[model samples]
Target: MERQKRTTIYDIALKLNLAASSVSRALSNSSKINAETKALVLKTAVEMNYQHNAMASNLRKGSNPTIGVVVPRINQDYFSNVIAGIEEVTYSRGYSLIICQSNEQHAREVDCVNALVNQHVSCVIISIAAETGTYGHLQQVLDRQIGLIQFDRVVDELDTFKVINNNETASLEAVSHLIEQGYRRIALLEGPQQLDIFRQRKAGYLAALRQHNIPVLEELMYENAWTKELGAVATAKLLDLENPPDAIFASTSDFSALGVLEVAANKGIQIPKELGICGYSNEPFTELTSPSITTIDQYSFKMGKTIAELYFEQTEGKAQIKPKTISIKPKLIVRKSTRRK
Candidate 1:
């Protein structure tokens, strides 16, 4: 029979002539253990080829040290960067991350959240699907006592911990900037109004127009154009009008703004001179565009860091409080696309 692996913490303690408790504490990363001793124990464990028993440790600690994240589309740069920030924090804390994509479907979002809860994840961070207007699935996570944190695209009905950009204010500022650039007849490439982010952004657009004494043209606002294809279609329709809009606010995202730019370019309309444009989400490609796209910077990765910190804060027993909401203000990044002067 093969000899059993005998390099346990106890064996290390005996070999080093140290107390068993000290060895255990060092292995467990307890603050009580001296830094040098902890380093020595870790180094010795590696040299001795001692594999950590994660299952036993988890059983002792009553946690699997994993966090589950759900998002609409992971292929998007914004979502990927957010996950990168989350992983950065959780990995340092010896926690694992499980990611799921909802494909912008309500049913899929529900299933993803349920699966994470079933896995007993210490926390669940999500950006609700565009099709998700209900909160029953999220409420289920709350009932299970698993920490729930929402970021970016979120459901407004849920009174849980949230990390969102100031969509309304940012939209207002973006629209106001366009107005100041002498674009009087402005159009909007809006998204699903059911989502609070879109609704607030629309409200901001309306507020800015009202502030500037511009008439609200119901015909100029096209809803559900949240993608480049839809934005291109909407642009064709808007520009075909007997009186085309002088400016377009692509409030859906930069991809939508790109669609607007493409349509304008194809139509031989000059940007900022005849057809000014702006977009949201501040994607990397925004600056690379011919005229460059004006957009809003939501500090996406920092938003992810804020969400992760919120999870640690709640789990760390800060304030003895219940679920909380934290809102991050978004800033408008002006580019040449909206410049008229």
Candidate 2:
């Protein structure tokens, strides 16, 4: 089938008996165009289904005015809140956004980055995937001279604008809270160690144990237990141990904590009373659970806004800027799940 021709300024000019230049100025809201002419042009354009070619105009101005965002998962609350925050700022600045999800796959993440680069986006914001192994793909973004901002899960070696949470400190606080509540044997459900965030969280867990004179029991620490299913399976195995942990900290996410809660409930284990639980990322469902789960609030929306603001600041004056890192501290939310005291 043949494609329908798009409405253009020339068509509107011909219909209105005006010069094409007049129609262009009116549609652009140029100050030179009178209000009456501008209003008439806008109305006629709407009626005629005229679509302004922003990309073509942006190209003429040597600016894209579009930001690309890549995340591990679009459905997760944390990432969604961040993207929403980014959109809020970008929209206000008359900038557009191109969002992509890597689904936690390294190869897919590389493809996403490359695609954004090919589009010649003004900037790229990303939270690296869990399976990402090297910084080469990120470096390629820099090689293309595209502005790059890394948030949440980031690469430490890369010299780029970074926005991150103090994961280790937050984890230390959560573990310490569990200990203060009288949970001596605390089990940790860690995410993939390849990601720096997970490594920092694990470090915090170990530090908390050392501070309280608690021995670091390797058996109690589970690896790659970042998801609900993995958390459930790990919980089952931990509970079957000869000397099981009295408390479990799903340091990856609230979803993991939910898995722990389910497994414990199935075994007739009472939360707080028998198995104190804590999770990271204070997702909405955390508060509505059977026993509200204690978790960390990363201020995801604020973090997202900060990321956008930082990008704008860097691009200001159109001069090359030095790389910087901005760390946002996360807060611990106490709830029935870990209020054993």
Candidate 3:
């Protein structure tokens, strides 16, 4: 369906038989406009369903109290919870949020950031997309002297406030837990290596195996198998190997781990006995599944709140302060999926 056009000042002015400037000044409650005229314009504007454009007014004053948030996929539970947390803090502070999704495309991400810049938002919060290989667009935000805060998936070299989970440490703890459970020959479903988060996780996985005197096998590590479908495909490939992994770690996400679980079940493989599964990002669905998933709790909601709260603390009055980094540690939650007798 076509969108309804917003009622503008011109429409209100025409209805009230007054100039558009008069309508604008009256709506703004200017001292030059008589009280009776201002009240009439306000009442008429309300009657005509006309809304004031706060953004335009704010832009004219060389500031915008609105914030822009961009994520890979808004439908995912992690991103949704993060957005909710950001809104909780920003709303309370009288700042509005403008959310956008990149759908994990680099070109789309650039466009989203550019659009937010054009609107002159107070701050731009982003968790970079998987396909984002370039940093020019992100640099543009900094060039404009706008507050740029990167969270979850961010560029390490950028001099901006960064809120991130300790992915490497979390991954180490997870893989070590698997080792302690006697799961030898573990397989890993990895995400895009271009992103720092995935690379750190992979580093953690390798470190854990070496620390336990276990030789790292290149065949056991699957590349870019971060999604549910990709995870299942990777699992099938791993299971078909001459020496299949006794345990699988979908370090990218719980969705991928769910894929691993489903595929193992379909093949009649006994979980935690014939096979073991572990995932990351303790999604809500992890506990609901049969033989619940072992995962890492990244505190996505809290991460969101931290990022937003940081923006307010550091950017008040647009202070040109030094960049800072805050890293939140994730906890490992062992469950039936990886638990063994």
Candidate 4:
């Protein structure tokens, strides 16, 4: 039941009655160690099941070929795809990835970043938490000259490499689609106002209303409804209103839009017939649901690859560079959820 002790160079040296340094040189196949000794140490290493600590050696040499990524949640399809994209590029470059989740908390995000910094990672890629309060932790990364790349939910004050989706334009296009469907008096399920992405989404929603000469009703806008539960609660409240909205846009996330669809179905509200629905982030489940949700595809995988490529090309791949911002435009995926004529 007890775990076996790992065999180190010292253990191999003690067993072979050779100096630890000689054993290390033999294991490394160094020229200083003759072929006979190298072969003997290697044979002994196999017998002892000795493993090399390449990372520890690399760390001591100040060349940690590892990248640290911090995201809100790995369970979410968007973040998972992003990580996979990053892996594709990093793996090819002979680098390893250290992934950490922030769980949408500022404190945890700081802790993850700090751990990455302590590890002396080559780069730190992050999509900040919803609680956008301070920049000290992020600033420390730049101070240490460690490559920092911020994507999606980024803070404007931080002058770092950024890869983001054009949330405003995407949201504008989504809302405009709802309007063209003749859905007047549309309601919005919003995210936290502190984050730029949410604010940009709100701006896009407002911009669309203004573009179509539609009056903006403050009452129809529900704040902090980025989750499925909040979206359902907002839907129930809006549906109960004396003059309920004919369309609901869960601009926060696909999860929120899913909530809207469920509440509408339970209330016998025909989607795109009596009420239109739309969501952001084209999660996998969005397409599978009956009356599939109309949502915006942020190309999360492409975004991830872009982030990784940017790090290699800009950070060490280039000699000198300025802080760059790369914005990827999201596409609108119209499905059965909002296809009314």
Which candidate number has the best lDDT?
Answer: 2
Q: Write the per-residue lDDT of candidate 1 for residues 141-189, one digit (tens) a residue.
A: 8888788888887776777788888889999999999999999999998
Residue pairs with clashing backbones, model 2: none
Query: For candidate 3, lDDT tens digit of each residue in 160-187?
Result: 9999999999999999999999998999
- Clashes per prediction? 0, 0, 0, 0
Give the winner by TM-score: 3 or 4: 4
What is model 2's C-alpha RMSD? 3.3
Regarding lDDT, does 2 or 4 come out ahead?
A: 2
Best by TM-score: 4
- Per-model TM-score on C-alpha atoms: 0.84, 0.89, 0.89, 0.93
lDDT per residue, candidate 2, 54-75, as tens digits?
Answer: 8877877778999999999999
Q: How many backbone clashes does candidate 4 have?
A: 0
lDDT of candidate 1 vs native?
0.88
Worst 10 residues of 4 by lDDT: 314-323
| Candidate no. 2 TM-score | 0.89
**Which pairs of residues clash in candidate 1, taking residues 3 or more apart in a chain or in different chains?**
none
